[model samples]
Structures are given as structure tokens and as C-alpha cells.
Target chain A: MMGLNKKDTSLFVVVIVLALLAPFFLNPFPTDSSMAQFNAGYPDLMQRFVIFGIFAVGFNILFGLTGYLSFGHAAFLGVGSYAAVWIFKLLTYNVLPAIMLSVIMAGIFALLIGYVSLRRSGIYFSILTLAFAQMSFALAYSVLSNPKFNLTNGETGLQVYANDPQWLHRDSLPDLPHLFGLSMRSTYEMTVGGWSFSFNTGYYLCAVILILTFYLSIRLFRSPFGMMLRAVKSNQQRMNYTGLNSRPYTLAAFVISGMYAGLAGGLLAAMDPLAGAERMQWTASGEVVLMTILGGAGTLIGPILGAGFIKYFENIFSKINDNILHQWFAFMPDGIEDFIVAVIHPFIGKGWHLTLGLMFMMVVIFLPGGLVEGGQRLARLLRRKKSDESPSADTKPAE
Target chain B: MGILEIKNVGKRFGGLQALSDVNLSVQENSVHAIIGPNGAGKSTLLNCLVGKLIPDTGSVTFQGQSLLGRHPHEINQMGVARVFQTPEIFGDLDVMENVMIPCFARRDGSFRMHAFETVMNEKELVEKAEQILIDVNMIDKRHMHSASLSRGDKRRLEMAMCLVQEPKLLLLDEPTAGMARADTNNTIDLLKEIKEKRDITMAIIEHDMHVVFSLAERITVLAQGTPLVEETPENIKGHPKVREAYLGEAQV
Candidate 1:
């Protein structure tokens, strides 16, 4: 089905189902309930989920398959955002062209960086990539944003101002980033008694692209090219001696992944119409790496899960302020409530990274295969317990 | 001229000359074995032929084409498959995948984008890989990880990977180098069967006289980066130059 084997087909379907019904799945708590603070069905947060999901998925194609840890992947994402915002400023506010150009620009950037960076392997390659990304950050942050040729517009970021030359802009068209007249921020709020779900058009568009990219990723994973990438990771000497060029194969993976990051960057701009130099920061790259590792690096759906996992925590968990904590603990005795709030203060809201870091470390130490491995282990354990009556129900080797 | 011709291939590394004033020819369809004592530059000569090292003095050609200055993959693309001293199969891949990769290399010529098509959907390549595995007697262990395979099986898998490419010239750098006596015999038998079943030329570097005498149709005794004698295996055993090259280590 869809060029995938039965196992992959089911996985693809699961992603589609989850992505399409995210508003419901993410908004399980009632809108009026105290737990509604944790709900992530808002248009802004939902867009971030699918956008970052694309970024991590692309990053995995390089880091996961070929075992090339690119420390500057966020540069591609930043470049994509800048390219996208430039399109919005020069052309119309339409997202299609912006997304396309962002991908192409990112690919070209990847080619240049990968060509030089891939000459060295292991930690050297990583450092090379990091250097390139930092250079890109410097270029966007100051060098390219001068008054004579204001491309990135310095630290203020590049956004569609009232006096910009949007050649395709018209009275009939939406003033914001959109597909035709359908604005990305356009959301349909649905209320079911005390429960509320927000279905945003922008989120849906990003979700569809995410699904398409996910399918393409699956195809690439199963194709001969994918096998060759794995071969590269395993042993380059064997690959070269077998009459296969490993350099071009790795370059291709790097470029494809770069394009994915760019597409994600374009989506981010489309959602908010702003491209900042901070997107190109090294911390952003590290965050994606953490996401990939936390969710499972090599598995097909692991990156998407990882991206969503991190984004959800970043948005929802970080919103838990002292006021909200105190409100929740108001029902308790005064002394006990204050003690509990004080104890939990460091892991909530502003200290959300502390929570995230602790979880990431735990996942790394215990579930080295990431969240997907944890799921598989749980599934196996359940199956074993269910079939304990039959002593012959031994564990099967992984296919 | 033979299919592979080497003329005055001298290679120097800093002060030491690894291979100097070497010349030899491996004819088509003949198993030519180059035997020598340790540090006799046997491996260096093989490396020169496969473009792993560039000779300081002369020419190395396969099928009338020069092998100098070419990359390893480029050398491989010109119908030369090399088996390393230790089996260099793709350890991370499965047994089937280890064989299939060479087929892809042979068909695609180094790099081709299979971004859309699935690996299993490549029916002809899959069939070819399967057939090669069967020939190597590894079809039963096709699903096993190549790394987990026994040492003998790794050698066989490496052979399958090379053979699937259908190269005209096969280079084995001590193919039976760290094997049990029984496994060595099995490899010898496998090589014999491969020689009988296919139209291929082999250039083998060996320390083991048993393997050299059994498989080599023409034997070249190399000593101090030079070939002292090139003759039939029978004549090579009797040659005094062969004994002198071996420093009286010859039990022939």
C-alpha cells in the first residue's frame, strides 16, 4: 500500500490519523477545567508541532541514516525562514512560492556546506557543520543586514511592513500569509459542551505537508538509496570497494534533509510572517538533535514523535506559572500547599528546560533507542504476559 | 598483452620503498597467485592494482586501461572487485543486503537515485542477489545479520558481494588468511567451484603455500618488491629462486 510494506503502511496511517485528529487528541481536557492550561490545540502551537516535525524528520535522514551528526542543521531552517519571508516581502503573501523557494535555497546552501563539511567524518564533520552554521548566523545577524543591502534587516527581523514592495499583493487577497485567500491563522473553533477544539487552516496545511514528507521519507528509507546510506554508515570501505560512491550519496542525504528543514522554516514564516536570525542559533540545532534522540533516531516516525514531544512540553509545561501552581494547590492545607509549590517551582514554567533535560537524560540512559523502543518493549512485555500460559511463546527476532 | 599488466610499479613511503621495480601480467581466466615472505611487498602490489596506492615508477593496467590515479570506486567500476585480507562485507546490513549492494553498484555505476522505487521492488537485482547467495551457499542465512555470522560465513558473504558485481578480474588479498584449516579448505573449494562456474580472472596474494599450490595455475614468487620467478605451480615449487626468496622457509 502506497509503495510501503504492511508494517510501514500501518505506521504511515497511524501518523496520518494522529496528525488529522490532533485537535481532539491534544485537547482532551475540558476548556473550563484547570487542566486546560496544558491543552495544545491552539493554532500557534499546533503549527509549531508540524513545522518542527518536518525539521526533525529531515535531520534524521542525515544523522539517523548515515550517522552524520550535522551540528548546523538549524542554519538551513533559518535560511528557509529568511528566504520565505523575503518572498512574502517581494512577491505576494502567498505561501506556496515562499515554501518552494525556501526549499530550493536550503538545498543550495546544504550543497555548499555538505560539499566542504563531508570531506571530514566523525567529530570533525560535526565541527565543520557547526562552523558553517555559526558563519551563517553571523551573516544573517549583521553582515548581510546592512543599510545599503538590507536582506535580513538585522536583529529587528524581516517582516512584511506597510510600505514594502509586495508586487502581487491586491485588495482581494488576504494581507497575511495564505494559500489563495485562506489565511494560515484562520481557525474554526468547535465547542462540545465544556470541551473546545480549535481547527486551524494553517495547522492543516502544515499537517498535510508533514504527511507528504513523511511518506517520502518512508520511501527513501526503503529504497536502494536508503540502503546505500545505511551501507555508508556501516562501512564506507566496503561500499567504495563494491563500486559505490559514498560521497555523492551522503551529499544527497544532506541536501534532502536541508530541504526538509527549509520547508519547515517556510511554514513557520507562513504561520507568523516573521523571520528572525535567532532561528539559525546553535541551540535550535541542539534542540532538534535532542528531539531526534529522545524520540528514537533511526526509526521512521521517531523524529516526528520527538518533535511533538518537545514542542508540547515547551508550550504547555512552560505555561505553568506560580499562580497556576498555587491555584491547583489551594484545596490543600496552607503549609503543605506552599511547600509543594516551592518544591515543584524549579521544574515548571521558566524552568521547563530542567524538566525536559531530566527526561532526555533518562531516555538516553534507559531507552537508548528512544521513545519508540520503549513502546516496542512495552508491547513485547504485554504480549509475553498474555501468552505466558503457552511456554513456547518465545520472543521472535526483529525483522 | 594479458588482461592485467604491471610494469615497473615502484611505490615509496618516506625513506622506505614499499614496492620497487615490480612487473607482472595476469592473463584472462587464470588464477595467478603472488606469494612471498612477510614485508615482501605482496599486499602493496595488490593495493597498487586496486588504486589504493599509486606506484612511484610505472603503469598498472586492467583490460588495457590504466589503473593509476583512479579512486577506489572508480577502479572498482572498471570490472575489478577486491576482497580484503580480512573479510570487508557490510557488517551492519543483513546477509542478503550485503550481496545486493554490489548488484546495485554494478547496475547503477556508483550513484543512482532510487528515491521513489523500493528495494524489494527491484525484482531483477533481488533475484540476482538471491542467486549469488545460493551459489555461495549463504541463501539459508540470508536473513541473519552479516556481523553475527561465523568467520567462514563472513568470507563467503564477502565473496558473494564481489561475485554479484560480475567482475572480470577478482583480487583476493589473502582470502584464507585467518581461517581454520577446515574453513581454509572450504574457501579453496568455493574458489575452485567459482572458477569452474564463471569466466573470471583471479589475482591472489597468499602466505599459505597449501592454498597457493591448490588454486594458482601460474605462481609468481615475489621477494624484496620484485618477482623472481613466474611459472606453473609445479615449476614454482622446484625453483631454487623460490627457496632463496623464502629464506629456506620453503617446506615444498
Candidate 2:
């Protein structure tokens, strides 16, 4: 059971099954059907789901367990992406080295940031992290992108160019990222009863890494170190008095989470072969925080669910247009349909963020534990009904 | 030599001297009680011992090592455990977890990377934690969230947390500060039982005369950041300096 308890083992198995069958399950709608646009089986989007899942899972280690809200995680992610892209430019186009280098680089960055930021706790800690991230973003955007010695390529982003020296790469090899000639973009397509499913090699690779990291995260969540982190969150004063140091534990959690973000960023570069300074923005950092909180902060599965939920809404909801809305509501009376569309228009399409904001507010107010708590509440209610009927069933048999 | 020694430890905050030339010694395996009126520097002295504050002058040492510049956890690792005035148990953790943390700290020192070791797999730690909980008479409530415990139970749990460390020196700041008579007596009895069974030194600061008289082997009365008298409980009761400093009245 990979050191997991029975319940966690089962949950792990369920996630494996879900990830394995995602292509088939996600592409449920026929190609020509009106609901085809809702299908999320595309390679690009699926890659995003697992990549961000890794990011949030790492974030949960720090914020969920240690209760240190880092407002600059995206800086590590950005650093990872830049490291990955630089690896692609100077070294071979193979993703393994790029991914490894990105993780290491991000870990180093996180260690520096965490060391300074952890000296302060509460909102002061958060502000310090934010300041560091902003400084990193500014460096990447301008200072590091000077013409004489450009590390990042300014606004155009860092990418592989034909003239760049890739020492490990042969001229005959394809320029795109690959695993021993199996191109990351390679996909296998199948059509069954007018429904098409596409399985991309890159997506599967990311999915496998995500599952491994998720398993590691689960182990960490149940470990003694995890308990120590929780104790830090609960009462740091007591932790210190109990002969436990809080700084090293918090810093370790920070570095681990930062590495996760780096892995995610490396995967992003592997998929697109570009690293942008925009990835380091505070808004990007806020998105991951929203994902962690909206799913449930402390729970193992909550962050993944939150990341997927937000990304799905971001992609699918933004695709909605007035014409599509009008077509869906055509069955209703013209006046009523127009009125409904007008009312709903602002919350969809480009305004999908408004809907996300509203949902986040609702979750914070009604379900402080996030969607996981909501699911648990539902499960409890169902269990209660089953228990209530069991006694009645026994009485009926006696009668 | 005593296990803990403080010599001429003075701390000044602006114009007011919080603690001025305060000297105290705590012997091994003895219970020393420090009693003081409000703003009498008892807390400041305790903070200095636990490395929460740096005295402006003089040295505070435990086992012949200076504790002046050490961090709180480092001070704790040197065999000093502190109990706060209000119970400082981890409210979010269970009772068992609250006790187990100190056991981990004791076994692993200040910090160890036990990130991958499942807590359930730590059989020895679990046994040790359970044994301490049993000693504290809280084994039955081990699974309960610590925050749900009554005030007295919280105090017991906090004491259990400190005791699990098996610290050589225990610093308790008013262990029964806000408790009723019954709870106070329960705490006193628990401390008495702990003292009987363990070869530990304790430094207790208290306002309650009943608790001080019942538990302390040596008593120090502090007034306006200076020790008025250091004597056995029987002698401290009739000492004129203590009576005047405490009651503002001259002995007849």
C-alpha cells in the first residue's frame, strides 16, 4: 500500500484509475455534437491539470500544514521555467535534465527566500515573500534581459533558437523536447462512434510524475514531520517549549513546496518550450493560493481537486460566448431568454473570474474546509439516512 | 553547585528596571517557588532563564552552560521545559499528539528530518507518549482534540507535554493561575506525584499562597524586581521583610 493506510491506499488507487481513464472519460461528447466544446480531453489542457495539481500539492505542505501563507511561490515556478528553458537552449532538448535542473534551481531560490521570510511570521512573512517575488519578476523582466548579457529575453520570453548552442544535441535530432526520440507532442488518436479520444505522450508523462509526487505528498502528510508542521501551525510557542525548532521545519516545507512549483514550471516549459516573466507575477501566485483554499487547505486530495476545478472553469467558462448563450436559450420565449442572457453575461466568458470569485467567497463562508468538507458533509448525510433505515428494516422483519 | 544559577541578572526597559541585580539558585531535584507582587519581575526572570530575553548584565546558566544568547528551542534542548501561565497545548492536535511532540523532540533533539516516517510506525514513541498520558491520568482522553478539554484538563495535558520530555529543569509560571480551588488542588497533587516519581528540579512562580506553601521546598519573595527574602516556607511565613513587602505593614 506504499505506506498508506487502507483508506488512503484506496483513494490512491481511485486517483490512478481516474488518471488512466481520463482521455476516454473526458471526451464523452461526440465530435459533431453541440456539447463537444465542453470536452476537456485536449492534450494542452490535460497537461495543465496535472502540472497545477503538483503545484498545489506542494503548496499544501507549507500553507496547509505549517499555516505559513507564501505569497511568492510563483517566483520559484518562474525560476524553474527559466532554468528549464535555459537547459533546453544550452543543453540537449531532452526533458529529464531540464526538469531536474529546474527543481534544483527552484529549491535553491526557495531556500534563500524561505530563510529570510521565515524570520518573520504572520502577515509580515507574507509581505516579505511578496516583495522578493516582485523583485525577482522585475529582474527577469528588465535587469536580466539586457542586450549585452541577456539571461531572459525581455518581453518575448526565453525560448530555444536555431543558432543557440545545444551541446548534447545532435544536428539530426528534432529541435522539440523529447524522451529518447519520443516527441513530447506525439499523440495517439482514436475515434469510436463519432467520439474522438486523443492520448498525448507528454500528458501521460506529467500524469505519472503527478501521481508519484501525490503519493509522496500523502506520505509526508501522514509522517512525523507532517505532524510537526501541524504542531507549528497549532502553537509555535508550545513547539519551541517542547524542544522542537520551528524555523528549520517551516523552511523545509517551504523548499519542498517550492520544488513542486518548479517541477510544475518545468513541465510547462517542456510542453511549450518557452518561459515568460509573466509567470512570476503576484496574480499567478494568488491563483495557486485560491486553488489550495477553494479545494480545502489541509486535506490531501483537496488541492488537486481545487487546481483542476479552477483551471477547468478558467478554460471552459471563458469559451462561452453571447451567441452560444443565445443558442442555448433559444427554446425559451425571446424576451425571457434575452433577459436571462443579459443577466448571466457578465459572469461568464471574459468575466468568468467574477464567477470564480463568487464561488471562492461562497466556499470560504459556507464551507471553510472547502469542497472536501462539502463532500464530507454530503457523505455524512447519506450515511445517516442509511443508518436511519436499518432499524426500520429490522423492525419490519420482526413484524 | 546548583543545577541552575542566576547571578546579578538585571534588565532595564527605558527608565524602569524590570529586574535589577536578581540572584537565585535552584538545586538539583528540588522544588523552588518564586512569589512576587504585580510588576515584580518574576516573569522577566523566567523569560531570561528560557532565553526569551537577554539580561542587560550578568549570566544565567544551566548545568554550567550560559543560556544568554541561545534560542528558546536550544534552551529547551538543554533540558529546560516551561509551562505557561495559560495552558499552551496545541489546540488543533489531539491529546496524544500534544504529548507525542515532546517525546519526538526529546528523542530527536532540536530538529530531525522525520518527514517520511509514519507516526503510526513509531511504536516506541507511541508507547512513551501513552505512558506519560497514563501517568497524567489522561490516557482515556488521548484521542480527544486538546481544545475541547476543560481548563483543568488542558493544564494537565500541558503538564503531560512538558513531563514527556523528561526535562531536567521544569519552569512553571503559575501552574494554577486561574483555576478554581478544586482544580488548583488537583494540579498541586499532580505536581506532588510528579515530584515524588521523577528526579526533576522545578522552578515555580505563583501568587496563590496555598499552592506555594503546599509544594515549595525553598521560597523567594520578590518585590519591585528585588528579592526580599529567600527562606524555607516555615521561616518565610514569619519573616518581617516578606510581611512588609507583601502587606505594606510593619511587623508589630
Candidate 3:
């Protein structure tokens, strides 16, 4: 809202209102119905909607503005998750310590990676980042491995036992710390008829922070710093000869994006009491790049929507089974239902990636600016058609 | 004492000698021009002065301080600003925003920091940037993106960006090289106006004799990376060595 245009400001307000009212609205759906399975309002997937949204939004700060395509940003995300988990083990299982550690760790990691990677520009820089991230992933897998109990636990992940103390988690403890030590985690449960909604304390906390981060990102996007970043992307030589050094500005943006990734990683562990090194994989890093490109890189809110869309499809489509497919096509004869299942089965199940890949290719090729431009084009086309039919009616501007 | 002094500066790049025993001294506030042929190393000398390249021998001193090992931005902070031959401006930034970068650099000093302060709310920075924009005749186009401006206007904006830094010495490397005759005249006028308003030293490299004769109080000529002559423009026009190296046949 701070720097948003009229349309974006309204859209942001609508999103916040929807996130708040989702539980109430979803409460009417049947408890055991398959439709409920598709509801993104569920805590596990809903948390991810905001978490990866933060990741993509942060990544936009670097690749979107500076044109520095980093292939190893996932390493920072993984570092953040590891730092957050370590905080859970040593300090309090509270979300605050985890978030703080994650940010600091990510910043340090970015500083190190940025110092070296920034030495080279363009494709070489991207390769440097990728090599560093792969090294990190390998180190995490081998060095942190345990013979008996896993430290990082490798691909299996490290989960916090309930016996572990949640220092600032109020719901987990009756007599939590007071005032300065007041717990931020507060859960409220509500039931309507046969439906129950577990309003998570952590989810709201993450949503509030994500909103704040989003607002900060918007400010960064519009500020002089943002202008400098865009200039660097446009022409580094021009910036250099203008008596400005491009390195420091690009580095600052990189560090800030890394901090945001760290914040997201910390939130992930907070929502679920586990941290996995798998989160830092190259593929995981590539996913955010895909999300940004598919949603329209450089446009605000596009990346977030892209994150939500990808996560939603991944969750919903992966859950589709033969039985569900057959049930949906049951209106046809039994043989027809079986035949339809056979055709749609591979595309929906294990083959979900092929569908996403095809969609990504189409979006990249046809709508290079992503869904945002696509939507704008559609709106313009419809308006043009209407204007042609009634020319005088379109005299006034749409704004 | 000369504010900027280059004593016996020489540089070699492997097999090629770019500059050899080149000595230049600029009095505190004078407009000095360097005229040279294609490979005479005028730009190489300028690069040494601004710390883009270090000389193989001799010392470059500005305000009695060595500029040998300092970074270009640091050299700029030391009050030496350079304008490229081509208009070097932040294309994505507006005219005023283009002017504001030097203000931020001069005010903040450090190139990169997580200041996290309201960059636009810096009152002094905004006022200085606006004032400079007015000086450059770009006040009306303050909100226009620099890339969209005409070539002349882009050059003006770049000049304004350097001027706002309030450098003790300004360097222009072939400022009007690609400009049309009209644009070249406008650029000369802009430089004249800026010189009248600011107390500054200037070292300029130019191929155009008309622009150089009109603006430069004193001129230095170079041939094959070695100084041919340094004299007043009137004397330079008549000097035998300067004429032989550059102007002899052209003045026919």
C-alpha cells in the first residue's frame, strides 16, 4: 500500500481480506469431501503459499532488478533452514530465535558467496553461484551426516521431538514467559457443524511478516536504490562512467534478497517443527526462478501469485488418484470411466511435472511477461471490442 | 603549486608503450585541453589520473595527495570527476534521479551501505540535485527518463551529474566526438557556462579544433604518447612543434 498504484493497492487489500476470511469460508465445505482436499486454506499448504512467496519475492530483488541470474540462491534458503533448526535445538523452539538466526546466517552466507561470485559478471557469475551451492549441498550431506542419529539427517530431515522445550511457544506450555518474554504463538480453534478449523498461531505470524516484507520489497522496487539496480542491469559501463561504482549497489541488493530467503526458510521450520537440507537443492532453487518467470519477473505481486499457483497445482494434482478420476467421469458408462482414467491418469499422477512443464513453456513462449501481461492483454482486448460497438461509451478513461 | 600535477608518468602494456615520460600540471582553476592523434594515449593519461590504470613510472598527485592506488570512485570522492565521450547516463533513471546519484555518493561517501533511510526524504540531496538540473537546462525534463532524452539533452544531464559532485577538477574525454555541429556548439556553450559558474580545473581531450580553439584557454598537444607542446591557444596555433605534430597541414 505504501507505493502501490490504485489497482495494486486494492488488489493487496483484497488479498489480505481473503487470507483472513478463508477459514470462515472454507468451514462450510464437507469435512471428508474430496473438495476439501483441494482447499488451499489447509495449514500445511497455506503456510507454503506464503513461505515460497517470500522466497520468490526476495529472488526478484536480484534477478528481477539487477539481471543477475543466480542459480544457487537455494543454497542460502537451505542455510537459513539449517540455522533456524539449530536455533530450535539450542535456544528456544520459539519462532523468533529461528527467524533471527536464519536472517543472520543467510546474510553471512550471501556475503561470502557474493564477494566471490560478484567478481565475475553474466553467465560466469551464475556458474560461480551454482558451483558454490552444490559444494554447500554436498558438505551438508556428508559432513553433517551421523552414523547413529542424523545431525542434518541428510535427505531424511531433522525433526524436533515434542520433549524439546518451546521457549516462547505459549500453547505448548501453560506458564510461558511474561511481558518481555510473552509468547507470540497463540492458537484459536473454531468448529461449525461437522467442520473444524485449526487457526494456527504461527501461520498468522508468518502472514503478518510476509506482508511487511512484501511492503518493504515494493519500497525497494521504487526507491533510488531500486533505480540504481535497474541502471546496473541496463548498462554497467554507463553507470561506471557516470562516477558510480556498480559493484556495491548490486551486492547490497543480493544481501537483502538473501535475508528475505532466510526469513522464509525460518518460517518453514516454524510452521512444521523440522528442517531439511533437501530444501536447499538446486531444483528447489530453480523452482523459485520458474515461479518468478511464470508470474512475470519485475512485476509486483506476480511472483507471489506465481508461488501460490505452482504450490496449489503441486499439492492438488499430486493427490489425484485413479479412484478420484474414475469418480469424476462416473457420469459416463463404466467402460468409458475406465478409459478416461487410463487417458487422464498419467497426466495427473506421477506425470504432474509434464503438465507443469508444458504450462511453463506455453507461458514463457506466448506470454513472456507472464500471467500479469496476459491478464492485461485480455482486459484490453475485451475493452477494445466493447469500445468499437459503442464508441461514445468508451470516451472516458478506465482509470 | 599546481592543484593537479602529473610528473614523468609512463605506462607500458606488455610490448606497447601507451605513455612515456608525460608531465602535466594544471593550475588551480584553468581550462586545459589535450589534443592528440588516434593512438597518442590521451585517454590512457586520463585513466591514470582517475585511477582506472596505474602508470608504470612517475606519480599523479591531486591536492598534494597521490592518486596511484585509489579506486575510481575514491578518486572521484577526492574531487576529480570524469565525463565520457559518449553520454554516460543511467537510462532507467529520470533526469533528476540521474543528478541525485552524485549527491548520494558525495553525501554518503561510501559506495555501498544498507542505509535503510528514506533516500527521497534526504532534503539536502533533493535540493542539490534539483539545483544542478536547473543549471543543466534540464529542469523541465526532470521527471523524464534519461534514455528518452535527445542526445544533446543526455549529454547535458551527464554534465549536470558531474557538476553536482562539485569536483575540484573535471575531465572530459572527447565530449563532442559524435555530436552534430549544432549539438557540438550547444555542448561548448554548456561547458563555457559551467566554467563561468564554478571555480574548477579541467583537463579535456578533443579532436575538434573549432571547439578546442573556442573554449580552451591553454592547450597541450600529444603525438605517439609523448607531449609535443603545451602553450596558450594563440601561441599553440603558431608554434612550429604543435603545428608539425597536429595542425600544420590542417591549418592550410
Candidate 4:
């Protein structure tokens, strides 16, 4: 309530409830059922959902509020991941320090990049960010992978080894990333009848972080700074004449979003304890953009929904092979089933990217407000219909 | 010395000389009007005053400080506010928000990190913005999106935005460029009321003789990127060079 009005407070509560109940909601299908393949309650995938949700939320701060699309957010995320891994190797296996270090490191990187990139706006700003991210990726891949430094560890990725210093680590504890003694990989499973739900310590940690960041995002969206950023998006010219210097506002938003990406990246490494240079690649940046836009750029919940939708399709849809398709279509006539499979084949499996593109196109064309707008429209229509019928019936009784 | 002084100001855009040897001085607490035909460099000169463009020659001094090389927002902080030919209110914000931005600037200087502060909770700013809205006769439409306002209301809102800042020097670029006669009259009345209520200096550029003759205490006529005459309204109306510039012929 500090920054949120009633509506925003309700939205925040709804997000908290949804996140807390995700293990049950996402794993609705029974383990023995054929539909279990679609279940997203597993530790790894659930962790990704929350992690990328954090990524998109951070991205929306800059893109949604200020309308400054930086195509290099993944660089911050990658730096965050690398920082977390280094903390694991030298400091300790405890994730709190690693995550803290990652966020700070990422903020520093973002400050440097935002300072230079914010000088030129529109497409020029985007290009500058893109160039900086590419340079970071190249440096991480080759230049930082020398025998003298070996910072990123080249293509094989950077991971904690048994021989690393880990000066703060105790010999009595397990060599995995943890919060004190609680292992990130620890899980608790519950079974009821034929259904089972497994909740991971790591996934819950990510979920809790995601919820906090989401709340912070809501606060940012409703704050005066948020209004200034929107003003920057609306008309920078008017802002200047109104006696506002837009550069510092835009730069702050950029750095804040970058820190969010870094937190997400740190979480990624905290879950798996590895950092890859590919995480900083431009495609990863594009993927987060897609998540933000596909979910709805300006809305709070749209990005999380978009990220979940894409990751779900990527993991589950791609697992559907010809044999699985054939199994599903076994009841049909041979020729027709084969034809149906052929038509559906290209858009699923390895063609999930194509499906993602098609879905993105349709969303942009029809639901430009993303899924959130679509939901609002549908709710309005339903309310209109209900009100229309009730009012007509009441008028008939009066007549 | 006048509050704002322009000395030998000249600017060229490649082949076109926009303003050449344009010298002008705006006295404190006086209404000055800059009237000229198309491409007479009125806009070019105004742009120079506000830091939108740097003059090739001469310096623009406000309160004896050079306005050259200062950013637009810097000039604004130095008690100079500008209203564009077309209203430049923040289109995405509500009318109240549009007014409150300038109020924030007035209170907070050019920039401040009020990121965590709830705008709704800023009681002082809200009251200031609402008072300005009432003064501008837009209190009823405070919640409306600025872009959706009628042209007259948008112009009124822009004026309110500028007035909220309590700027020392208010530069208006054709404040009534496109308006119905009644709306233009309303704007004139509003400007008159503001001038009466505040010790503010105004420099207006206009093509409307009604607006210029009604509001300006002093008038400067620019012709072919040069100031042809600077005189009081009565003297400007009877000036031979002014009549020649408008009628395209010198009268005996």
C-alpha cells in the first residue's frame, strides 16, 4: 500500500496466491496419465518459469515505462550468472552472497552501458545497446577465456570445481549451492490418490524472489518516477520544456531493469551452479523482448504469462515426436491420420519457434494489449451480457 | 538593461539566413510582441532564446547571464518557460499530471529521484496543480487525458502548465495560431488576467493583429530576418516601415 492503490494491491495478492499454489495448479494432471507430459510442476521447468518471469519484469520497467527497447539485457543477465558462479568458486556455496554479488555487479555493468547508450535515443539507442551486448558476448566467449585469465572458461562454461578455494566453505557441508544448510535441490513430494505434486526448495526460492520483484515492479509502475518515465515515452520534447532532464530518468530505469535481469541470472546459476556465455547472446535478449511483448509490454502480469507460455511450449511441445503424434492419431484412418500428422508436424516439435512466431503475430495483430488486455475485454463482454439480461428481465417484470 | 537581451543574434541554415543582426531587448514586467510575415525568422530567433538552436553570431542573455550553450531545461530552471505554437502537453498523462510535472520541476529543480514517492500522496503538488487548473478554468476536466482535450482546452492547459512554474520570462510562439475567434478571445482574456495577477515578462510571436494590438505593451516588427522596428503599440501602428512591411509598399 506504500505505492500501490487498491487495484494494484489486489493484483499483487492475486500474483502471490498464484505463485504459492503453482505446484498444485501446474501439476493438475496425474502422473500415470498421458497428459502428464504437459505438467510444468517439475523443479527445473518451474525454476525457469519464475526466473524468466523475473527477467521479463525487469525488462518491462525500461521498455514499458520509458519505451526504450534495449536489445542487450541478456548481457546483464549473463554477467550476473558469471558473477554468481565466481562467488561459488572462490567465496562459498551459500547462494545469498552469490546473488547479492551478482545484482551489484550487474548494476555496475548496466550503469556503464546505460550511461553511453542513453545519449542517443530511439533506434540509435537500441543499436548502441545491441552493439555493447554483442561485444560483451564476444569478450566472454574468446577474449576472457585465455590461460592468463580464463574468466568465462570459453564454450564449456564456468562451473565450480572441487579444487576451487571456497574459503568460507565448511568441510562438513555438501559442495552444492545452498542457503546455509538447506540444499537448493532439496524437494518435498506429496501424493493424493493417483496425483503427485513435488515442490523444490530452489523453485520456491525463485518464486519468492519473483513475487518480491513483481511487487517492486508494481511500486515502480505506480511511483512518480514511473510517471516521469511514461512522460519520457510520451513526449521527451515536452518533458524538456517542462524543466525535466529526461536522461537521468531513462538511465535509472535502464539500470533498474538491468539489475532485475541480473537477479534473474544469479538465480539461474544458484539453481544449477553454472554460467554459459550463450546466456549473454543477442538471441537471449530477443527472447526476453518476445516474452515482454507477447505477454503485453505495459502490463505487470503479461510478461510472466508470456514467459511461461513460451517456455512451456518450448519444453513440452518440442517433446511431441512423430511417434507420439502417430500414437495420438492411431484411432483415425491410416491415410487421414498420416495427413493430419504431416500438417501439424512442422508447427510443433523442432518447429516450436515457428509456432511461437505465429502466436506472437496473432497476439500483435488481434490482442495488441497482450493476454491481459484480452482477459479484460472478455471480462467486460461477460459483464455486459449479464447486465443486459438482468436489466431486460427487470424491465419486463416492471412492464 | 532589459530582463532579456539579444545582441547581434544571427543564425544560418546552409543557404538560408534565418536571423541576421537581430537585436532586441525585453524589459522587465512588460508584454512584448514579435510580429513578422512568413520566414521572417521569428521562430529562429525564439529558438535561439530557448536554447533550441545556437546563433551563429551574438549572445542571448537572460538576467545578464548568457543563455547560449545552456540546455532547454536549464533555461527553464533559470525562470524562462516556453509555450509552443502547437500545445506540447504530455499526451499520455491526464490534465492534472501534465500540470503537476511543471510544478514538480518548480519545487524539485530540474531533476530529482522521487521514484518511490507516491504522486497522489504529494499533497502540496496536487493542490498547486489543482489551483492552476481552477485558474485556467479546466478544473472539471482535470482527470481527462490531455490528448483527448479540445484544441482550446489543450491551449488553456498548456498555459496553465507554463503559469504554474511562475516563470519570469514566458516565451509564446503564436499562442493563437489556430483557434476560433471566441477561443482566441478567451486566450487573450486569460493572458490579460495572468499579466494582471503576476509580475511576469512575456514575449509573444503572432500573425494575429488583434492579439498583438490587444496584448502587447511594446511591439517589434521583423522583416527579412532583421528587426525593422521596435516601438510602443501606438507608434508601431503608425510606423511607416511597419506599414510598408505589411502592405509591400512604402506610403508617403
lDDT of 4 by residue, A1-399 (tens): 656888889889998988888999999899999888888899999999999999999999999999999999999999999999999999999999999999999999999999999999999999999999999999999999999999999899999987999999998776798998789999999999989998899998999999999998998887888889999999899889888899999999999999999999999999999999999999999999999999999899999998998889889888888888998999999999999999999988899899889989999999998878788788777767787978753322110
The docking category that best describes candidate 4 is medium
**Residue A287 lDDT in model 1?**
92
iRMSD value for model 2:
0.8
Off by over 4 Å in 4: A392-399, B250-252
Candidate 3 residue pairs in backbone clash? none
lDDT of model 4, residue A195: 92
Candidate models: Cα lDDT each: 0.93, 0.93, 0.81, 0.93
Worst 10 residues of 3 chain A by lDDT: A174-183
lDDT of 3 at B129: 90
| List of chain B TM-scores, one per candidate | 0.97, 0.98, 0.95, 0.98
CAPRI verdict (incorrect, acceptable, medium, high) for model 3? acceptable
Off by over 4 Å in 2: A392-399, B250-252
lDDT of 3 by residue, A101-177 (tens): 88999999999999899989999999999998888888777667777655687777766666766454555442321
Error of 2 at A211 (Å): 0.3
| lDDT string, candidate 2, B163-196, tens digits | 8888999999999998999999999999999999
